[model samples]
Target: MHPLNDIFVQSAAIFLELATSEFMRYILAAAGLHLLLSTLLKPLVRRRKIRPAWPPKGQVRREILASIRSVLVFSMLSLGAVWAVKAGWTQVYREADAHGWFYFGISVLVLIVGHDTWFYWVHRLLHDKRLYQGWHHLHHRSFNPTPFTAFAFNTGEAFLHGLFTPLLILVLPVSYLALFVFSVHMIVRNTVGHCGVELFPATRGGRPLLGWLTTVTHHDLHHASPGWNYGLYFTFWDRLMKTEHPDYLKHFSAAVRAEPMKRAKPVALSIAIAASVFCAAVLSGSGRAEATETAALETISGRWVTEGYGAVVRLQPCDKAPMELCGRLDWIWDPASGSYLGMEMLSGFRLQGAEWRDGEITIPGKNQVFRSTIKVLDHNTLKVRGCALVVCRKQTWRRLESLPHIGLR
Candidate 1:
């Protein structure tokens, strides 16, 4: 046999052995957690399931199969990292002490933060319509993902996912121990995020500490909604980009309290009561029926066309508690923009003086939310203002008795 052929054979054998080991390691890590969280620990927190219904029949099975395929892809991609390491191209080191104890710890931190930033941007790019249908859509097919879905990725997506660690190794002097820790942390968090249960406890008011970490509800919403909550380990990117589902905090709070569906009843009831009171106040032409604030909030309710005729938004009570006020995108001028339709646009507005204050308004197309307030200028007009940091913008929306014809624009 030719010497080159023998070398080729030896390399192929090594690659297959490494791939098998990685595959088993991933399978065990994922499946072990799945057993603990989704099975063994499930009955203890059965009430905390993010979605009421069990995943569709065979969903977990499909996710497992896809995950296996992705693992193979990941393993194949691992060869590149192995080659880089052997060639002394990567900064990976064998001894943890080479970086000292503190730098060793810091390297782990760097890998996590860097991986998060890398994941956020790559994950967002995967959601592009062009990439989504062919690539990301495979993973998304498990709309209600399981722990197995942690590794489920399209072939291209697995390739992209696998590149992160290799690239990190090339750029940073990551110890093998740090790399191992990073890999372990990655699988554990990835599975937990996709575990279809909200495992994180909610902080008080759902705005501190645990709030910064991504909850199972956060990633579950990403599966259910497909267009929001793209973060993996933390809420930083999603919050900064304003791509977080408006109800994320509410959902997390409900999950932690094990009162997921129960919270909806009061919101629905409050909306009905508010509407009835407003109508009565208007008909009686008296302040006796409802508070002036209630009347104003009621008047703000209805479909209104955005400035420049961009879209129609319907204002109503948010499904979350306090039920102050919220808005949903009802219609858009472009049919292609229909995905933005029905998305929450405003949330948590409450009457303060003549304006509804302390509201959040999401900008169409930009996927950004800003501090907002709205006021009714007349029966037919509303003044809406939003601020990010110190920059503020205001727009007027005309009340729409009915939706304008899509062709009219």
Candidate 2:
């Protein structure tokens, strides 16, 4: 067989394995949680008569169909993960001790936090008027969601959501077990958020400590009113941005107050199990940290389009100094205006903590350099900011796999 054919065959096999496994995981998680909460638990826990019945009329069937479509789309996207793992582009490790138990816990936390951040931004983006009708309107169809609505996403929306996992794995070192745990955590939280009942206790002003955490009511409000409550796992972004629904507290209080006191044992047991798992993850043994070459710079190497789509820059390793980062203008929207192609745009960047700072970016039209910082929002997005004294300009650039045809405007 040809070398390319051999590689293709191997990738196909990996994709099949990953897709099948992921599909099963989605079905089991969504279905099992739905059955447990909507069918079994809700009936047992009701203390008083609620105005609206659970599951609502006709919502379950729509949710089921939509979720099935989402599963297929997600399964297809899992191929990207398989390719990354096989090509050694991902930081996935088979050995649990490769990065130590402590690092494993940290990695899991990072994945969750990273995922929440990504979801919040992307979710908000999808709500944009230009994108909402095509990308996100299908999801809002389920005004009163059941558990099945947890995974019910439009194909475009599904692809965006599915892309997060593969992108995260590419940039971060994660173990197989840690990824599995993250998957479980994702599904459980997703199911509870859409479960249509408040499983958390009511607090005075929603409890200061728990306020940062999203509850079932938080996402439920998002469905009820699409503009507010755009968080998936954490409420930090919504709270900070003041996008949370105004009546969120009143709704949460009503839901919590309705829970029957007689069924407290089951809810308590569930919380206890979750707490134990968290404790175990944190208190696990520490091992020797792995000493490996940092690929932090390589993770950000790619072609990026400027925010206004004004210019395209290709980022690569500096030839003269391998440790330094450099970018050159590859294309300009208006070539007749003054071709900047091959002109250096970025240089002198080094990794500083979570961001790549102490860099300089040349202003395209004006022959001037300004202090700049670059941070990888994800595998396909870079946040670049340039500061000139008190005046600053920021742009979120999207990665391009290949350069496009540039013509004079």
Candidate 3:
């Protein structure tokens, strides 16, 4: 594992261990709020005498099969998770005691990607022309689905869709608790999306406002058009795959149809930004300033290398100010980092338009990278140098004029 990463994981584990009490209390508080919402708010909907029509009987078979497939796949995924943990897949996950956090994260990420792959395939299959006429067409019967409609699927379609995660786990190694959390989050999100209840977008207690679940309008539209809005939890797949309804905006309720789903706000923002940039460029005479390539970035323009406990740095254009104007280091090898620690040198430093102007000299090292400058110091010699901290050292060059013309050209 990377040293910085290792330290970060260890620190997080310690923090969690130390704050277990606070963590539990926070969990308890969340649970309490959920309980209150279920007992109070949900019942209000029932008392309001609102009920939605269930999907056709044919659609019912899909949900039943989906649930079964979901269970089977999860059991297999458990085995995969165990195997990954035992394998010590990476240095990050090698130290089991210290790296459980990353291990868990890895497992969940694998599960999600796996699920997406499978869901995409299965969903595509369900939409296939041949299958839609027979096995998959029934689910599309609903014109406006309520909460009950979310699970409305053909048995075969549901099985294919829901089996993704478990099948993925068969090939992966995931933490059991992590899997559990992932499952719960997925189910809750799916169900709440289908719940058909528009929530207050304002913050309840300075937290996410209506972010806990997909809005009622989001799912209700799906039910209205079976081929569209098939995704659960997130909207990415539907939009990305072009499976979303074409008239979703036109038919959308005013409450939910605020400006045609906005087309993922960022697109407009990006275009606006681009247009603004273009206009700015036009205003500023094409926004292109005449530039001469005299150096790389200032931070990287100098020399660099990693040595023992401490490093050595040298600065050039050697003014009285003792910082890394430029310099170079000898050479070193970092066995752990698997990187070469080498020296660098440079000269003729000055502020160039938006960048530092200077010449660079580099000395490549084994298992390490190096850099420097070539100013054609003299015809008989060349400047050689390296750096550890800042500029390590600098010496006037005395070689065959320019380069073998090998890399220098």
Candidate 4:
């Protein structure tokens, strides 16, 4: 046997061992937390459920399967750290006292804070319209995520997240203990954040320390509305960016209070309750009620002629997701394009304030879709924007009712 071959074989074995160890650690942490919170302690955790509704069937299974792939990607990347350590390339040290007790402790804290900073920026990057479908969509698939959804990342996302440890070790000196603690803390908080349960009580208004850190509700709201709450361990970055959801505190308070049938309030009492709520809102000088009313009243459901009046699309409540809007091609100016009629042109348009967001719109003559948002400009006009990657284009859609001469197209 050749000497080079012997080195290669040994290196491969070490990589495999490291990969297996990392994979099992993830499985144990994710599954153990799921069983503990979602099954064994359901009665308790259910009281602080962030969202009253449960995830749809098969969601958990899908999450776990997708997570397995992510674990492999993570494991493979971790091997790079091991190799770096052997090559004397990274600051990773094994001895506890090598860095002194004080430095050891500080290193652990630094890793936590550094990882948080890394996560905030990387997460925001993943949400770029060009990268979302390829990198972030898998994680967001679990709108009502569970513990199993913690590492359910797309391959691109897994690679980016997995790169953290290797890159960190290369620049920052850390002990093995610090790395272990960081890994454990990261996965635990991640699973809990996705568990769809708020484990912390509401903090006092403007409370210090506790108010600054993120709770389960913070990350869960990110899953519910991806445009906000991009921070991982703390609210500092999101708040600094002015990207934290405005209703975050209100949602946190509601989750902790555990109002029974919160999302399913009886219709009989709705009007009376709504009246009282409206009065309280007005007295408090809050404009949220008016915004809600506007969202509900501005129906974008109707046939509209696309820009250039080249096509007509019918917007309606999606059959598969009744709460969201879907659009289908109703007609096109070109008679030969009849085959495109009845084809879905837009989907997954959820109401967010006065705009419909996080939707996909198909581009003509292409087999792809891009991120889209629609806003009602008036009773007869709509503002439609589509984005592919970093570039965005806008279009104005006029109601089909305004076009009286359809026969002369």
| Most accurate candidate by TM-score | 2
lDDT of 3: 0.42
lDDT tens digits, residue span 1-409, model 2:
3434434654565555555555555565556655555344555346311226665587777877787788777777777776667568988876666878999999999989989999999999999999999999988887877767887788899999989988888888888779878887887688767767666654444332277789887888898889999999998899889998988877776666644556556665765554354333322211111111037666778778888788878888765555567899988878774666788899867554466655689977886676777888888888887766555678999877633453322
Candidate with top lDDT is 4
lDDT of 3 by residue, 1-409 (tens): 3434433543444333323322232223223323433554454333221124534565434543443344444334433433343354412122222446776777776666556556555766777798886666655564533333444556666556556554555456554456545654444444444444433232312222344233445556665655676555555677777776665433333332232324325333543443343233222321122122323222233322222212323444333322225554432343542242434434433332322322344444334222332332333433444333343454553322123542221
What lDDT does candidate 3 reach at residue 135?
60
| Better model by TM-score: candidate 1 vs candidate 3 | 1
Candidate 1 per-residue lDDT over residues 384-404, each given as its tens digit: 877776566789988876435
**CA error at residue 404 for candidate 4, angstroms:** 99
Off by over 4 Å in 3: 1-39, 42-98, 141-152, 199-216, 246-409
Clashing pairs in 2: none
Assess the local accuracy of residue 246 in candidate 4 as a C-alpha lDDT between 0 and 100.
Answer: 95
Model 2 alpha-carbon miss at residue 141, Å: 0.4
lDDT of 4 by residue, 125-209 (tens): 9999999999999999999988789889999999998888889899999887688778777876786678787765333341222
TM-score each candidate: 0.61, 0.61, 0.39, 0.61
